[model samples]
Target: MPQKKLMLLGGLRYLLPVIEEAHKLGVYVITADYLPDNIAHKYSDEYCNVSIIDKDAVLRAARELKIDGILSHAVDPGVTAAAYVAEKMGLPFQCSYEAACILQDKSLFRKFLSEHGFNCPKAKGYTNVEDALEDVGFFNWPVIVKPVDSAGSKGVTKVTDKADLKSAIETALSASITKNCIIEDFLDKVGAQSSADIFTVDGKLVYPAYSDQLFDKNAANPYTPAIEIWPASMEQKFQDDLTAQLQRLFTLLGVKSGIYNVESRVCSDGKAYIMEVSPRGGGNRIAELQDMATGQSLIVGEIKKALGMPMDDITAPQYDGVWCNFILHSSEEGSLVSIEIDPEFKSKYVRDVGLIVKPGDHITPFKGANNSLGTLFLRFETREELDAAISNPDSWVHIKLK
Candidate 1:
């Protein structure tokens, strides 16, 4: 028999490790996207110039290639496209096409959660700014506005005043391909946000991993995750409650075998709320961090699930130490000169470093995951040390530029 073939959508750098994993297992890898110069295409066995956002077109390409399995690991658009192709081609899929639509669209997902009694923010979607502003007085102050379908916090905003509502809605509308945006009551978090990777197999939740989602308030886009700590700092009781809610959601939404990027928080009212759960690998090495902390390869598990292989590696994750990931970024735009990690923490704490840009490369201001300069992996001996470093990263790490 011929070797199994894997078709990956969107040629982002995150697909590189997936391509490598397929090659290691002797599977042919085909990367597809509209851009010809995407880095992942260089390592793939073949390249297809199909737009991942166009579900029907991508499905046609997959059929022509006779792909054994379809996957879109770390990219947002790939999630729905991969599901669409997989369902149409009779390939293994983690979630149904209907479920993907709900998870991909913020309006549908929020509505589903509220209807099902899941702890979710009161949200409503609108196609035009005028409609969104019409009911501004109905909501509490300090609301969040975001695109209905975009990811990476590309158009997320926190509006504390009614005067800023229209601009926020317009910003979100611009980012959404559907020209739709959601305005929701802002949740007051009790602690750092709980955002991490979770897994499921055959419609049953295998395990739920939690992380301490960190943010740089001074960041141009403060909604994006700036740092994440494994085995979150949340109380055990809250974590357990969150897990129960997640299981309910997985079963309700028909989430099948695969890794899921989930977000939640313990609110000030002492309730755990399921903020978002997307059926795709999160950008910025979340799966890699899960592998580092938990001894399980989410990437491999995703590949196996997509290819109809046994997911023997899907086990309860146990973190060996307090692990963390820092998404290195700059708030200013310029050519990179040199990246300097303060020697104070480098000798025994930092485990690995991935610098995506070299000296003299023009770098944009950090607004989303796409602007991340690189990632730093740390294995802390204690939780205190990890917390300290994360709370004040500027003192220990700095990216210099011209």
Candidate 2:
């Protein structure tokens, strides 16, 4: 048989590891992006300069290359293109084009969740400010106004009073790509950021990881705070119950196989209010963290699932390692002075250090994941060590923004 070919959509920064993992597994990888400078572009077997949003362009390129399987692990914008190609070619894809559209559009996703009996915050989508403003009172204090078609918290605002609602909606809608946003009840009642990333083999739920989430609340509008932990601190029973609910979602959504990343807030009452679910791997180096914590790479799992391989080989994590990732961000948007990740900090537990910022480079406060300076991936023997390391960013590298 010929070597399996993997087609990836999006640039290299976030998608690089997926390419690296594919190459490590001896798969022929093709990366597609509109820009030639995309990080993954250099590493792939073939690089195609094509717009990710143009489904026809992506499908044409995939056909020309005769790709074996198509997948985009961490990038959200590329998921629909990947799905379109996969569906057109009869290739193994985790979701349908309709499903991808639903997930990408917050309004549609909320409706779908409601139809399936999942508890979602009351929300309304609007392209016109007047329409959204009409239902301002629907939400109690601390309402969340966010872009309908944005991710990583871009244009997301928490309005605690009516006076701020209109401004927040305008701000969110202005930043939205679709010129629309959904206003929803803000569930600020937090406990842990728990997520269940599950895989189903032949329609059977295999493994689910539900862990507490840590975020930096200070990040800008579109860029919600970044995550910092996995295999989160939570009761085992909570995980099991959450797993059951996720399995039902998978079944309801017709997600038989492939990777699914679902975000939620496990309230103090232990209820998992569904936040969002992406039919792709977690972004911001979470895939690498998952591998470090579980001994299974989501990149490889995605490839295997696409190739119709048995899922059992890479199903669960073997080690009880704590996985944490932090995005290097600036206090203000400007120019970079210096990013100093000390050389003396190398250890077995520290799996990877990626620094995308260079001295003298112009830097900006993160507007979204796009503005992030870099990322850090860590693996620890115990939770205590992980907590200590995460709490002390002083010991970690610092990027001086001028």
Candidate 3:
């Protein structure tokens, strides 16, 4: 029998595990992107040098390769393209191409939520700064401006004053691939925001895992998640409500079995809002962390589903203990000297440290997930210990820069 071919759309390090799983399943892995030097390509059986964001180009490559399935994985820019190719080839995908478009664009997602009577913030998308400035009064104070099509919080800004609106719009537009941006009322969350990966089967949510998405205010981009702890502190009632709403949203969109990166929050107004939902694994190794906390592997299940194979049994995860995935980054831009972790913390809490950079390598301040040096996996016996350690990471985790 011929080996099944799986075409992955991005070359990010996140695809490394997917490639490994595919190889374990006796499948051929092909990493596709314009960059030939991407790390995932090194591990893949073949490399396709085509722009993943260009759907037509990717479709051509997929046809030539005779691929059986395709996935975008943690790469946001290629989700729509992957869907397009999957639909054209009658392959498995989480949702249709149209649904992928709606989920991938922040502006369209907000509109969909509002139309569906979800707890959606008042927001507007703009292609030009002049028009957004003209409609400044449309939104409430303390609004967030972000690109309509970018992820990892690449161009997200919190603007409390009208004076900063135009510049924020420009920043968002620059980050956007479609030259579009959205201005929306910021939901002052009741507690820590939730950003984690969840799974669904036949449009019904099967696994719901939530995390307390943390950010470092001292970082260049406070919007990017700096640390994500499993078992979010959100009340159980709210979590249940959010899970039901997510299932409904998926059913309405005709979503099937796959993993989704979800961002939600309970606002001070006593309403739960689904901030964002994308049909792809989240960056920052969210699925990987879930595997550590629970004995289940979403990565393996996702690989199986992508290849038109029956998925492993997926159910609600029972976390063994509190866990956090700390994104390693620097507060200042310079050549790296070394990463220092307090001896006591390392011995007691830290489970693993993965560093991408070494001494003499140049590094930059944390602006987005792309700016991260690597990750640190830590397990805590209690939530209190986890909170205390993350709150004062400077005392234990230090990045010496020259």
* Highest TM-score against the true fold, candidate: 3
TM-score of 1: 0.97
Each candidate: what lDDT? 0.87, 0.75, 0.92
Clash count for candidate 1 is 0
Better of 1 and 2 by TM-score: 1
Candidate 3 lDDT over 169-228, as tens digits, reads: 999999999999999998899988999999988888999978898899889998889989
lDDT tens digits, residue span 1-402, model 1: 798989999898788888988888888999999999999999999999998999999999999999999988878877888888899998888799999989989999999999999888889999998888889887777899999988888988999979999999999999998899999999999988977878898787787888898887877898888898988889989988988888888889777788888888999989998888888888888898788777889888888888887776577788989998889999889999889888868887888787789999999887888888989999997999887888787788888888
Model 1 CA lDDT for position 36: 90
Error of 3 at 49 (Å): 0.5
lDDT value, residue 130 of candidate 2: 85
lDDT digits (tens) for residues 185-241 of candidate 2: 777645676654656565566756665666665655433555567766766666666
C-alpha TM-score for every candidate: 0.97, 0.91, 0.98
User: What's the lDDT for residue 369 in model 1?
Assistant: 81
Model 3 ranges with Cα > 4 A deviation: none
TM-score of 2: 0.91
lDDT-wise, the better of 1 and 3 is 3
Higher-scoring candidate on TM-score, 1 or 3: 3
Q: Which residue pairs in candidate 3 have backbone atoms (N, alpha carbon, C) closer than 3 angstroms, thus clashing?
A: none
